[model samples]
Target: MAEWVPVFRGEELPPGLMRVVTIGDQRILVANVEGTFYAIGAVCTHTEGYLDEGYIEDRTVVCPIHFSRFSLISGEVVEGPAEEPEPTYPVEVRNGIVYVQR
Candidate 1:
């Protein structure tokens, strides 16, 4: 099992925002959707599109390069150019701190 690592203070990320964080050589995209936190791979599966450069549409993150829409909840492909799912990390909030587990 992977241990959870503190990524950010809960107040740092408000609702409807996305941030890039690095944890022990792993680059992860942390998204805040109405107070719910989700962490996903920063790299797009189809191409080398940087996910952090993409915009969030509702619960999906659109790839900036090819415009692939990836579900934030399941990391599944909502729209294509990408057939693979993005890897999502487990997230939790405690006492105003956000933690992400690989």
Candidate 2:
């Protein structure tokens, strides 16, 4: 069964901002693009850098260590040094709260 965990409220993450939260053993990176929310793996596949500490450009999250860019929505490796794509979680806004489907 899939579990939905509430991470934050809709107003907590503004446009072009990223938030990091650890749930159990999973480190989640939540990004706000325009007004939509996207959740992905926090650790960069290149160097284990935190994606939340990196910059947000368009729909891509760049790694702070190696400048590898990953798509926030699809979790694809858009830029290199990181060949593998990160895992992404489905996000849903319900009653003004942001929930991550796991």
Q: Quick one: best lDDT, which candidate?
A: 2
Candidate 2 per-residue lDDT, tens place, 1-102, comes to 899999989998899899998877999999999999999999998899998889999899999999999999899999999999999999999999999988
Worst 10 residues of 1 by lDDT: 41-50
Candidate 2 lDDT at 48 equals 96
Superposing all C-alpha atoms, what RMSD in Å does each candidate have to the true structure?
0.8, 0.6
Full-model lDDT for every candidate? 0.92, 0.93
Ten contiguous residues with the weakest lDDT in model 2: 15-24
Per residue, candidate 1 scores C-alpha lDDT tens digits across 1-102 of 699999889999889889989988988999999889989888899996889899999999999999999999899999998999999999999899999997
Candidate 2 wrongly placed segments (more than 4 Å): none
